[model samples]
Target: MATLADRLDRCYSGAIYDVMRDMGLRPGVLPRTIRGLVPDQRVAGPVFTVRGRPDPEVDAHTSLLEWTGLLSRAPAGHVIVCQPQDDTRALMGELSAEALKLRGVRGYIVDGGCRDTELIIEQGFPVFCRYTTPVDIVAAWRPEAFDEPVTIGNVTIRAGDFVLADRDGIIVIPADRAKEIIARTEAVIATESELRRAIRAGEDPQRAYLQYGKF
Candidate 1:
């Protein structure tokens, strides 16, 4: 049987959004600032959440070690969702992206900044972030927590939740409800496909919606 991640990977973000809304799980999309660097790249996986901030007491040496540890321990087939409280510096760079890819990390989603845009794009490692900057977390930033809940754009994401992202946007599904959401989304896709066919065949919009109960 296909895993939850595999099943989610087969659906686009729009369908997932519709299914979640129909199920009453509102506020699923991440902030508009977080966009895929490669808009065509679609990724779906379990979330490995990280929450970070600039610490006045954590020295540079210790901060580096802490950040390194967090990345090194990222589980295979997971997407790293980070909420770095500061936006002045990049939380992810080329080396980190390479390491995550080597460990089978599906992709990254950061509600902050990222660097090494050219190389990251060339490598085709899917990354979604607010923006890019040359400044990095060498001095004061450190992850305060991992594998915990983090909020981005009013959507609370917890570790083990499912993330589906594409050119349209990113949608987070509650882990317990992911399977059911996927099943519903498949039905939605099928209905939409048929609706498209009917419209192209010159069927009236009102009749189509009446027949399909959707349009």
Candidate 2:
């Protein structure tokens, strides 16, 4: 399987942005809680996603160790995308990030909060989440599920879908539509590039946008 980086290079992040715009999704940074923890780090990959919900039963638990095991064994170049049921509480922290980095995992995307933002950003590991908190998971939450469909913002993410995120925002490309999206996104990029060049060369920006469908 092609790594996320490899596929992204072919289609380009700008192209993905175009697709997202075409789909009527507003692009904004996910909440600041998600951050990177490695030097010069950015992660892009097909999402091996999981979702979790709060459980009152203390015994209803899924071990992070087990999840790390899957990360370690995952095919090289895949990302572990996680969606937490509770957006207000931190679910991942420095320890979990350290294990993921060591396992050669790409990065994480969560719709919830995370701890250790400073260390994570200093280390340069890429994480995207909703908020940051000082909370821990000892009694607050549990990882009760894996490899399931999850929602982040307005996007529905499935276990095997392709995810591309950067400074702009994250875009989810369905597994079955990957190839088609890639092709369309590439075309959008080319069109926009030409329009940009024309505008830079003194052509009317409005005319360019009207002709190309985007500025």
Candidate 3:
């Protein structure tokens, strides 16, 4: 049987959002400023949330140890969603991305900066962030907590919540509703296929929408 993450990985962002809205969840969309560096790639999985901030007083060595510790603590088969809370320096970089990827981490999404863009992109790792910079989080930042609640835009995300992201945008789905939302989205997609065929077969668009109760 496919796990919820596997099933969700197969669903697109739009359909998932529509299903959640129709189901009255009214899910919170992640900030538009935060977008996938690899737009053609889609990543979906349960989140391992990281919340961190700048610590200028910390030494570079200590900050690096703390940074690598974050990577080490991330569980395999999970997407790391981070609210770095500071945009002055890159929160992710080449070595971090490579480490996370080799460990079977699904992806990285951060509301901050990323360094080593070319290398990370070439590595085929999924990274979504606000921007890129050569300046890294050596002594400028430190992880405050993991698996704790973090907010991005209007969404207050918990560690276990499910996330589906693609070119359209990213949306958070409460873990408890993953199965229900996925099942409904499958039904909606089937209806859309039928409606599309009807429209292509010369049926009036409005009539097809009426017939299928959707368009």
Candidate 4:
């Protein structure tokens, strides 16, 4: 059997949203402003939550130490989702992206800005954020907590909850329901495939949708 990450990577955001809707689950989507670094850079995995706060009084060296410590603490095979309360400076940069990627972090998503966009793009590390900036979190930010619930848009994301993000948008599934959600999404995709086939085979689109119960 494929792992949840493997199954999720094969799933797209739209179909997942549809499945969750049919199940009456909240559409745990992030804000539209926060988006992937590169086009078609889809990411799906269990999330490692990171939250930060402004610390303007801290010295650069101390702030950097704390930041690097957070980097070292991140585990492999998980996407890091951050809620940096500060909005001006970037929470992620070239070295940070490289370090996380080297350490096997699947990807990163932040509800703030990012820096070193060109280099990060060159590295091909998936980073979803609201915008890009040259300002960085040197002495202005500090890691507040991890694995705590953080709200990005209308959804509260907890650690270990699964996320599916693509060109359309990002959606979160409660950890307890992730597997079931994926299974349902796979079934939805399969049904959609059959629906497509019938329509292409000269069947009326409306009739095919009625026959397949999906459009």
Candidate 5:
């Protein structure tokens, strides 16, 4: 069986995204609070997804604590992707990152916001998000559920989907399509390489692109 890290290292966010786009599937972004701790650190793993809706009346401090506890039990290399209804709150921070790190998590992809940017960057964890903020998730919001489906951008992400994220962005490959996508992606890479070689050898870029259907 291939480990999560192994699969992640084998693919790039761009390739996976292209595959999904070609297939007409839209995937969402992981929460922004979850970030990378290392430089150039990309994570590929099965998503242990969470969905949170706005609840100004509920106290989220306790909910976050409990959520972190649940995440600690996630299988090794499981990437925790959270979708908070409100993109403004900083749902992830140093403490949460530390806990996830201990659990052998691959990384995080969030659409909201994050804090402790300096520490997270220093820790060399890979995180992808819309922005960073100093505000924390506390009295503002609560985690309404887990292991549920969420949407980011045009992508629909469900728990257990294979997630590959890098500097370009995040891509979710349905669990059932992992092997197929991997095979297709390999062919794409090879074709692109050949096309590049042809271009370098003085072939017209347009001709090369048309021949391979890729630039």
Candidate 6:
């Protein structure tokens, strides 16, 4: 049998969202402001959460420590779901992305700006962020915590939750519920596939939806 992670790797964010909703889970989706740096890049992995904010009190030495610490701690096969409370600085760049990739980290979902996007895209690293900027964290930002619950848009994301992202958007499924959700999502996909075939054969969409309960 395929693992939940493997099954989820084959699932789309939209299908996963519907499955989660059917499970009575909110399907915590990051806002539309975030988008993939590389077109068609998709990521599915357990999240390693990071939360940070702008702190005017920090100086050069402390800033160096902060950046290095966050970068070094991310484990392999995990998506870095970062919440940088201050949106001015670019929290991710080419060099950091390179390190994460080498460490086997899957991708990034940042609720802040990112820089060196051209190089990041060139490296084929999947990074979804609010925007791109040339500004950096040297002057005013520091990591507050990691592996902690953080909110993005209206969603509350906890460390270890599964993150699935594509051009559509990013969605977080609670870690404990991922397996069940994936199983149901596979069934949902089968139903959708059947519905597609019916529609192509000239079946009315309304009738197909009525028969399949999905369109």
Q: Can you write out model 3's per-residue Cα lDDT over 1-215, one digit (the tens) per residue?
A: 88888988878888988888877788779988888887796788999999999998999999999999999999999999999999789988888999999999999999899989889999999999999888988888999999999999889999889998899899998888877888888888888999888988999988887899986
Cα error of candidate 2 at position 198, Å: 1.7
Best of the two (5, 6) by lDDT? 6
- Please list the C-alpha lDDT of all candidates, in the order they appear: 0.90, 0.66, 0.90, 0.92, 0.72, 0.89
Model 1's alpha-carbon lDDT is 0.90
State the lDDT at 154 in candidate 4. Answer: 80
- lDDT tens per residue, model 1, 121-188: 88889999999999989867998899999999899999999999899999999998988998999889
Clashes of 6: 0
Model 4, 1-215: lDDT tens per residue?
Answer: 88899899999999999999999988798888889888788888999999999987999999999999999989999999999987898989999999999999989999999999999999999999998899998888999899889989788999999998899989998999998999999999999999988988999988997899999
lDDT of 2: 0.66
Question: Candidate 6's residue-wise lDDT over 132-189, tens digit each?
Answer: 8999898579998999999999998998889899979898999888778888999999
Single out the weakest 10-residue window by summed lDDT for candidate 5: 30-39
Tens digit per residue, CA lDDT, model 2, 1-215 = 86445666466455776676676755333333444433234557777877766655444144444444545554445677777778567766786777677667677877777889887776566777767889755544666556777766556777777777665456667777666666677778778789888998998878887888886
lDDT of 4 at 185: 95
RMSD of each: 1.4, 4.2, 1.0, 0.9, 3.4, 1.5
For candidate 5, write residues 10-109 as lDDT tens digits: 8777776676678776644443433454437688888888777666676666756656665665566778777787868776788777767777887777
Q: What is the lDDT of residue 59 in candidate 4?
A: 92
lDDT against true structure, model 6? 0.89
Question: In model 4, which runs have C-alpha deviations exceeding 4 angstroms?
Answer: none
> Clashing pairs in model 3?
none
Q: Which regions in candidate 1 have their CA more than 4 angstroms from the true location?
A: none
In terms of TM-score, which candidate is strongest? 4
- By TM-score, the better pick of 4 and 6 is 4
Clashing pairs in 1: none
How far off is residue 172 in model 5, in Å?
A: 1.9
